[model samples]
Target: MKLIFSIRSYDWIDYAAGLILSESDIYHVMILLKDDDGSMCDCKNFCSQAIYEQRKFDLFNVGKKLGVKKLINLGYDADEIDINKLTSQLQLYLMLSGVNEVYCQYSLPILEILKNICNKLNIKLYFYNIEDRKDEYLMVVGKEIRLSNDIINIKNNLSNLTIGRYTIVVNNETKERFYYIYKE
Candidate 1:
């Protein structure tokens, strides 16, 4: 069983199969709205328009013909229905349909929440890196004082040295350390 996540711009819609619906394979098609920020406004104002609505209807009709059991809307801010809550709801839906796998675009917070949900439901969540086409990387910094290896070596070798945005600290016994001002 497969689960599908639909992403339009920054909003995400997660869908799982239901007992009434059974599809062997699930496909996640991202609707790329041509606009700045492409928020819910895009879906409400533009997508709901007659022309776009027809297009969506056609797409859904085709998907139905192709045996798509569920359709999910993903990417919008879930302030009221946040990621954790949404995933919990989706987990129940997937469980009813016997879905085992989920496919989705990259949304770190949502992905993390979904991971937890999947763990609880014993389902596997799969993430597709859509941003890789632009060559982007996401980094998480754990500490403010963690310095690069080069900066550490330099601070260790020199009693007092200053590198770009880094301050080298040298101990009385000749131990070397690096420090940087907290950016806060």
Candidate 2:
């Protein structure tokens, strides 16, 4: 599966780039919202408890626009950065938004805290690492085959055929194959 980690600062783009590149079904985009102090604030609320609700509302609105499945807070501080505190704060925001997944940018401490919280809340935790290269490719070929009404009639006529795997080919090359395992 593809996963994206959205951080709280643009500076994290480099760090995130080293992990993920380009966007696809498995990997999308990681959005980072920077704090006023140029540090990752997790969401819009960090230090002040009074603004927690407001921050959560703002985050939900932004996340909805971005189509983010989950949101993570990367709290940074000059003196001391508390991963547990940040995780707790983010958990509240996620709960309010009805999001289950929380992510981090290679922060082991933050991941551990998220793990504990997920276990307590019965939410699933996913840690995504950037692969060196994409592994799979899908291709669809159309010109080599043609379908007519006769094929539909044939399919209907085969209603009594025992459910099993069948291979249909125009020539020696296999054009289409299907497995009908559960037909009554």
Candidate 3:
């Protein structure tokens, strides 16, 4: 089974698109929620909190879009960057459920922690850039790409692919100057 570990809600859509293309079972899709800054966050308090209305909507829509309804909310935490708590929770979960692979696109602070966890869990960790959003189809599609699908747009924005511990990158593969994220 493949798992995606996305912390930010904005990143969820891209990961969801990738997960969909990867053909990972929706049953295994879990949102590592509650890297959350508090105990009383916009937890399903959608359309209520103006402070986080947009986030709540995004979280709900993204999960629903990915067919992942279950969430692992680490309830009651004040520290925003609580690496220890996050790692511990993740370890416990992995102890109970062995993982086949995990994909995460994130900045620093959690990188080392995630690497250690993946190593301990003995699972493959794929680290694609935040920009490498929706390109699983591009890897397999023919060169004469002419997609006008309503569900997926062909931004062709993938630049790198990380499998295991290796990062394969594009060095002038395309002449296009800008990368675009497919908007839904």
> Pick by lDDT: which candidate is best?
3
Q: Estimate each model's TM-score.
A: 0.45, 0.36, 0.55
- lDDT order, best first, reads 3, 1, 2
Score each candidate by Cα lDDT. 0.42, 0.39, 0.47
Candidate 1: clashing pairs of residues: 10-75, 11-74, 11-75, 11-76, 12-73, 12-74, 12-75, 12-76, 13-73, 13-74
Write candidate 2's Cα lDDT for 1-184 as tens digits: 3334444333223222222222222323333332334111223233443333343444454334334445454445434666566666756744554544433454456567666766777655555333322432111111112224443333333322212112344666553233121111
Question: What are the per-residue Cα lDDT tens digits for candidate 3 across 1-184?
Answer: 5566665434444434544543546434444443322212213332324423444544455555556545443433334556777788777766676666666656565567778888987877665453444453332111122234533442233211100111123683423122244432
Off by over 4 Å in 1: 9-52, 74-81, 134-184
Output the number of the TM-score-best candidate. 3
RMSD (Å) per prediction: 18.9, 20.3, 11.2
Per residue, candidate 1 scores C-alpha lDDT tens digits across 1-184 of 6655544421221121121132335544433231122213123343334434444454465345445554444334434445555666666766676777766556666567667778888877666544433332211122122344543343233212211111123563332222221111
**Deviation in angstroms for 142 in model 1?**
27
| lDDT for position 86 in model 3 | 77
